[model samples]
Target: MIVKYTKPGRNLIMVPMLILLTGVSSCASRPPSSVLQPVRLVQNESEKITLLAITNRDRESDGKGFGSRWAAKLTYEKYRFSIPSERKSTAIVYPSKNPDPRRQFVVTARKQLLDSELIDDATSAANFDGTVAVFVHGYNYSYQEALFRTAQMAADASTLSPPILFSWPSAASVTGYVTDRDAALYSRGELERLLGALAKDSRVKRIVLFGHSMGGFLSMEAAAQLKLQGRRDVMAKLQIVLAAPDIDVDVFRSQLRDLGHMQTPITLLVSKTDRALTISSVIGGERPRIGRLDIDDPMIR
Candidate 1:
């Protein structure tokens, strides 16, 4: 696969890293096994899609639903399935002739696996390709939302080798902004542990960290934590891509200062016109969020 790069000043932004899909995508909702056909047509299309997830969200309804609070028990789940492109027209994966909420696109998933075995499975998959992509979701996201979002990103891109999700409990409500912020901060240690696990896994060659909104802050903070531990080797093999980060500019600068010189290249994707960020700016004492970056500002320069 050919990778593309765009450099704006010192920052190196990778194109087509995370393709955000908008719609009714759910991790719990999966396509059936009938979608996987016996024939192989296009080599470009994915044969199988798998996402390894690490989460702090509490399980609900006897593990049927995922809650929005941080749990002391760190759980891991592996989701795998074939895409719509891989099979003939099934009511699953591909939308029906007429839109039917009752017949929504479903991608079937394998039985859930727990514990370090999740890491082992991901590492084995990476052994052949030596590449892995780690995705962190923004605030106001439930555990399943984060899972499906990352799944869509990985499947749609078709370029990402393997996708892994690091899900922190986000309260999943607009009213829980303060609570979510605290939770994001608290998740730094687990993020560090996840990153360190991937970095130390000899089978994995490179890691790409992709973060959106509050997840971006967690990504940077986790990187800072790793740096403080003198894990330059891990940083060397990592690439960071942040989109519309809801980070305070001052805090971001301080995190950068703590990081000092970094081996990993961080790409920041921002839009000043984002109305949600505008509200965040107001709530944050009129200080512009890092997502609404001023490129000309010497702080970032």
Candidate 2:
């Protein structure tokens, strides 16, 4: 979502920023560790979900956790969440203090995962299916929010294997659209490295790469990088799913041209009613965004 300021209509650029400003005003982000502080109590009615998170963000100065800054090195951390029994579908509630596990999500456990422990734990979680789901979140996300959101999606899907989250450094601010865009592009190679790591393990037979919003753009970039590099061995085990991706139409066509010869077909989850993408299109001088693609258009068909 690199919003280049153009002269066509200065009015057009303000539209998205206005929306972003209004959006952030209504929903302010909680304190850094507000929802992330570990809750030792495990509720009987709540379901416990564990996941693997891989990130390129800088760790805290004290090395206790991660921050919003970008980093060159990759990190692996394991997390467990307690999903509230009373939680509504598609609703996520972050606690400000004294979380109620039966009514709100809670972080039960978290720790760094060593290289040797990653495979053993990943294999055990995959169980008989040998499938691993990796999620890449879009722009305007903090590391904690990404972790919680990934766990929620995994819980909703009832996935069989452990979910791995690829968290890139995002400014996590409404005004940081360009910063997030650069960070997303910067993390594509790291995403490829994550794939390479999982592909080497014999137990991981299937890898699903799910990216939402701008993260979908990163996913495609990494996929194209692998394709051009002749990484067929890793590509064979990969299945890509892009949900409401904020990718440009012409750029997507170019990427598809490069990826057309691959053995597996890509799954695109598009919607004409995605307002975020509608604004994104307007910001890009009214250029078409793939997420807002009209399937019935004659030229598109």
Candidate 3:
């Protein structure tokens, strides 16, 4: 006769069984699309736009150093801009000894667009007829990468009359995350200076500020600073668009509230499948803030 073996207690068996089931189910299911895809912005519609881009020089150099020079090499290929070799002395003047050369380059590009009269100027409220789109790029982007992205946006939103970019120092480096954060803070003053200059132009009626990844945090800070300085008057002239911002959802909302409840309409472009943001979240020891929550989240709402 065979002897009957005694069974383990329910509590011990249940937990292990559940875990095994969960593991099997997870293995059976496909991973989320965002897990497999890269993060990118989608531009559609709107016309007569100006782009302001904030770039990270340190990021560009890092790509070069690491021999992954995709940002530097592929910048111009993706966007249409007059290369230095193709540029005339009258077309644009390069900055000399600027603290942030990337920013200077972006400014120079904007000036070229303005000088060419390819896009209208925002000089008065009555002159506001088109869109002014400003882009603040995220971490680890090189100078060329930023330029190309700006150009690509311009091309994608060809209907926008004049696009301007606002470039900020990102100090793009993997190990320099802290330094980059500090740098972004340091550049707030410059952003404020730029906003002051833009607000004086009455022609700027419909302004769109687009900030991506970490750039979103910097953009929000800059906007808040502008509001505190009574520069909120410019809010009447603009719309704010944030894409995959790297700040905490709560922080973003609080800042908006402090800025007079976001006097202007705000749009957030979000993608849950952004690997970069995922990595950012992990490093920061926080949950990822995806675009899906932009509407329902109380903080952003």
**lDDT by residue for model 1 (150-212), tens:** 655565566444578888988776667789889999999999888888888887777888878
> What pairs collide in candidate 1?
30-106, 30-107, 30-108, 31-106, 31-107, 31-108
Q: Which ten residues in a row have the lowest lDDT in candidate 3?
A: 16-25
TM-score of each: 0.77, 0.86, 0.58
All predictions: root-mean-square deviation over Cα?
A: 6.8, 7.9, 18.3
Ranking by lDDT: 2, 1, 3
Winner by lDDT: 2
CA lDDT, every model vs. true structure: 0.66, 0.73, 0.46
Give candidate 2's error at residue 45 in angstroms: 5.0
Regions more than 4 Å wrong, model 3:
1-130, 287-301
Query: What's the count of clashing pairs in each model shown?
Result: 6, 0, 35
lDDT of 3 by residue, 1-301 (tens): 1111111112321111111111001112222212111112122212223443332222323232111121221111111232232322222222233212222222222222322132234332243455556666666544444444554445444433435555555444555455656766766776666555566565555666766667778888988888777776666665666665667666765776767655555555555555556656777787645332444456634
Off by over 4 Å in 2: 1-26, 62-64
Candidate 3 global lDDT: 0.46
Worst 10 residues of 2 by lDDT: 13-22
